[model samples]
Target: MTPLRQRHLTTAILLTLSCTIAIAKTPVATGTGGAVATISEEASRAALTILNRGGNAVDAAVAAAATLGVTDPFSCGVGGGGFMVLYLAKDKRVITIDHRETAPMSFQPAVFLDNGKEMDFETVVASGMSVGVPGTVRGWHEALQRYGTMSFRDVLAPAIGVADKGFTVSENFTHLVDQNTAKFSRFPATAALYLRNGKAIRAGTLLRNPDLARTYQTLARGGVKAFYQGPLARAIVDAVNRPATAPGMTVRGGAMTLADLANYEARIRQPVHSTYRGYDLYGMPLPSSGGVAVFEALNILEGWDLKSLPRDRAEHLYLEASRLAFADRNAYLADPEYVDAPIAGLLSKGYAAQRRALVDETRAASGPVAAGDPYPFQQDASVPLRPAAVKLQQEGAHTTHLTVSDKDGNIVSYTFTIESWGGSGIVVPGHGFLLNNEMTDFDFTGPQPNVPEAGKRPRSSMAPTIALKDGKPAFSIGSPGGATIITTVLQTIVNYVDLGMRMDQAVDAPRLSERNGTATDIEPGFATGAQAGTLARYGQRWSDAPEEIGAANALVFNPDGTVTAVSEGHRHGIGSALVQKSAH
Candidate 1:
């Protein structure tokens, strides 16, 4: 047999083994009432508690987000920022809140470079220079004030309780701690809190953060002002500006000030809207590229009969469409306030048709694919198309996502991040939260759309999406994978709507990512077999990677007034709850 045939035979054996192993897993749950899905069990339960207390989805989301700060601190907290895509069933509206972190007033494009060369990853990540003015607290406050029925104090109570009483550390948390012990040890506050005897505390150890509890209490009592304008804000600024004094660690501090925090406001923007198979999809708009990328990819794929194609061929088409979308993402998407992003043209079905024609079903586009001129389809046709910039460095996979829905039909999909695990490795002395390294999301060495600028929010790939069917909420889904977030979410939706899988199966299915890059990365099960050769024939380089795509959580609203929530099992501590409330 030929080498390709031999590889196929090996993959067949692997697929058989995978099928055997898959049979042992527990079945996904389905129920009625309301649903909460998050990366942590504690957070999920906290949201469910709020939902049970007659709170709307926004209230439950805030509660769950705050709880995640306590239980999954490494991924997100007050020190981070994120976007919330909210659906108010009563009003039948989709509101997207942009709480993405902004560059400090002192920021410049060259901040992450030394003598014109990009600084090493460690120098940038572990330094305060990577810190941005955190916007998550403000976002939580804004979300609650506008659409929630619960008070800030009520929503924060569970998180405060979690912080004060402590929770057992999971194996994943322990691994992260162990992995970054050196960086954590560089800062006194981080070292004191997370490390014991020069090593990470063992898994299952009940750890309490009294300082974070106090911070939560302060915010609960005083509201957003306490975090942005009070002593807590001062403490945050002080911690970020404090230099690392350890040997061989030459990373400098940041210039975040009280003004940066106080000036921060989470603005409400219209969600990016699109249609896929008669279902309306709404995603968080720029500085998040997720919604546009998904919209564009779906539009491109709409030309094909995806369900009728072979599974391998469908995967090939999906990868190509993703690449095309990511090309636009890298070239055009950015903070809308900073760039004249061609949003209209980018999402237009006409433009998508134009780009879709570039794809050859028999083979992938050879050579480096550049972004198309989408401005032609816009009303303002004078908008110029810039050459595609080199793809930015991949973001660390330390983000967290949650989806919540209440009995009243309110839904919220939120994706938050501190940029990386133990962001900046510098916890505030009294605040007990790590500062975000979100500044690193900006391009340092190029005239890219996401170049750092004073007070500008960095571009993001945090896609929180909700799909509506016949003007009724159908699904709310999102993931935490940095650059891979867009592809992961797109795949999940395709799996559910096109392939006809359950939400749980959609989230659990193998995923692939092609971020306008040369190679397409595929997860275990789907990477093997004749598909590899099929993809290779299309000039697509296949990378069989594992667990690097995303950990997506999704909730599907069934026709019988029931809901099913699924938390992908790849990440530890994932939890989903369905609470059935009686009809009034």
Candidate 2:
């Protein structure tokens, strides 16, 4: 359900304006031919339109992601970057693409420090120091060049149309806008685009971005180089270094040279591979902690017969496993270019067994738990053991996700984001897009795994996963919630694979996020469930989440060869799940 703060207005005019959009934001669809699932109906339509035009899953994914830049601007756009996990049907191989944002080459570890003291987080978030060089446009270019069946112009047409013609703003958009009013109002470009007379637009208002459409057209005409090497690049750099602030509003500028943009490239990386109950799973590799952390936790849980256990007992184990995995993740994982993550050791079942031994089913472990040593399992006993404890860091919950599949069995699971709502709060003048605040994702304090460095990608928790049952596509799932993303994906897979719940049931089930914290964050449904009291007796402390944990989209391949696409029934204003044709 939409949060109480986002309750829709009861007025004939507003309802009519919202209904006029024509596309229904249906939360679930199971059908034949092809399928697309995302948080917005406009984006779903964009993907379906591509599928109908003979584009492959890779093409459809790019289309949906671009459309989301228009419909869900607060979360993602060309101004951001992300990870993509794709399955090529013809090749029968699952590969991952890493297009995550990178720190500028001139960036230093002490960027957020003053007189050896860390700056206030809120101030740093809106300054130029927070911006990361974006990798989205190049990432899309790579995906299309590698596997797509259509031209960039063809896939981009849908998003351009959506941007030129507006969609009715929903309660979710209004809520996000209201939440970021102070930030948005600081810049003339951002303010003029989102606000009306210096105020947030109401739900059902028509929101258009001709500037973004024109920007898309520019890319269509000049190609990716136009964005990375020319006027667009200059405009982006100017916006970062000399932020356009409202009179009397002061914000720090950042140092981002055109060299940073031109030097950017999306790389093809090996997917993080593991197995559960005979199912082969693939996830995005480092720079992203999602795949490794999920694997470690699942390996720990695999020791138990969760299917036969009672609900409370099983959930207690789930929380403990997540806590332990996060402890390891915080201490060890970061940008692979800068740190040699112990990939071999972290995913080893023997290491998981060691971690699992510490979990007492009867009582929750006190946190922050010390990160375990996996060097022995890595067969590199000479490597020094890691520091015992690490601080818990939280990332922006403002990211977007989508999943797509073609009739040919190709699939793409993607998650992308601008660092925070309104990002650095500066929009590129003439061209329209937010610059990412992703630099702030790094640790401000010293001697940590995720501290910022030149050309290093910050650690991310986006786990876009594809699983194989008998070496065929079984399911593709992902979500958008900072650190909670790992737990959401892990818990959903557990719900479907271990608990035997339907795909939709797994997506809808109440969420609990345990990141080696003193208390796990729980959704209202979980806190109110009958088993909540029983779990508490096991020493599982609960803290109600301010908003739902994750907005997720998924698809399951059935035994009969049909695909089931599922989205949240209510979270983030009812996500859209659609297929090329209805099952009935």
Candidate 3:
């Protein structure tokens, strides 16, 4: 071996040894029946229960997701929308579902702007105008009808039970409620649902939402029609249009009509596919840029010997790759129905090669790099490439993710959101669920592909992903963290596959994210003296704050038919396995 190759081999060996020794051993929940991982323990348990009861992965996913809506209401609910990535083991095929929220047909691009100026930040967040026509309920119904073996009523039972019987408020729930007291107080129904005696309910307080339970029950009994066309739909519209009168403001409400709700539909789109180190990666496609971005970053990193590099250098490379990927993400990714995103070009190995050539190993790219031209690599030149435009919109970290797998080999990775905590702070009067401020996901200020438009789904960062090894399902993973979701998933895959970390260690490892920015945000433990200095040489400004990067959950399907599931403990996530007990 050459001197350089030998040196790299030695360094890799040493680094691996150090990392193995440094990482604290964490237990991996394993079982033969199935596995469930999620942000809430109750949700994980609900999924496991479904798996043990002969439910398929799809059924368990729906049950777990529904439970999360009840247990983690501040993050996601029936009033929101999300995406799901599923692997049908029987068919050996992958499916992606896009239930992302859409702008009302009456909505205009300037809705969030006043007289050509941006509206007050508070108004944009708390007002009815921020609400989008919700699609979560419809999405759930579609998943059950198409892929699930169980009925909608059966899948929703756990969520309904939780909502009706009530659950103890978790510390996270209490903290979020306390933080949003001002906004929640603006809406009487919201305050009544979450607060008591003008104070945020403390942790351990038994909180129940009978109205939400009734809504879920109505859907269970009447199906999707109950939510999209019946009383619940009307209640949503009226509540969104109801004017708010605060002490110093009278914010006008939304223009969501019954037609908007009636016309809402969840679509089954093609999953974005790529290969990294012989592993086939599948992610949700647009209106989510996550899959494309992750693929792009992976494609770029494929050219490097990450294992040969020192840990800090490896991290620097990751940051640079993410920056390049996000630059393209900001410019091109959007709702494919409304915008001509260059899917073929973006995922092409040739295009990735071109983008990879632009990376500087010794220094970071100065300033924000403009999106590259990916159209030249497209096979079909019939559709002209739209000019790229930069879109800057604030996104929150409030969201939930769940992953489930069954002994049948089926797998599900799902991520859902309401845009922000207590989304729009508008509870549909008597419904007890928060409406999504998903409209804020659009770029109102920029003339971009993701600009708000009638009948257009907002661009999203919800990426539910699955990876396969040697033509068998290996991992089902996803996370909840707005734009950071892509980077989080990418890092976990890198940690597990490239760095040779165990499944639990991969999910628990410290993470860093750089979303086309000069500053690289690192979790506290990962940013320190020598490593920080090495990254600084690459022109990376460090932000050591514990940025809520993402709460990722993953399930590793072993070749022997057993499954290992892991949840990021730092985020208070939980994992459970449906182990079959040998006859006692």
The most accurate candidate by lDDT is 2
- Model 2 misplacement above 4 A: 1-23, 525-529
Task: Score every model by TM-score.
Answer: 0.92, 0.95, 0.92
> lDDT per residue, candidate 2, 364-420, as tens digits?
886668889888898985756576587788588778889999999999999999978
Indicate the worst ten consecutive residues by lDDT in candidate 1.
Answer: 18-27
lDDT for 212 (candidate 3):
84
Segments in model 3 whose C-alpha atoms lie over 4 Å from true places: 1-27, 243-249, 382-391, 524-530, 573-584
lDDT of 1 by residue, 1-584 (tens): 35564445334422332232212222244666677888776677677677765678898899889988988888899999999999988889999999999998998888888888988877788988999999999999889888887666677777777788788898878988998899898887888889998899889999999999999889866889999997898888888887544456555888988999999988899999999999999999999999999989999999998999887677778888998998888888889998989999999999999999999897876644788988878888474756655664667777989998887788899999998888788888877888888988887777888888999998899999999999998898999888889999999988888888888878877777888776777776655667677677777776645555677888888898778777876645444544444223
Per-residue lDDT tens digits of candidate 3, residues 363-410? Answer: 887767778888888887486756664644677777888888887888
lDDT of model 3, residue 269: 88
Off by over 4 Å in 1: 1-28, 244-250, 383-385, 524-534, 544-546, 581-584
What TM-score number comes out for model 3? 0.92
In candidate 3, position 214 carries an lDDT of 88
Rank ordering of all candidates by TM-score, starting from the highest: 2, 1, 3
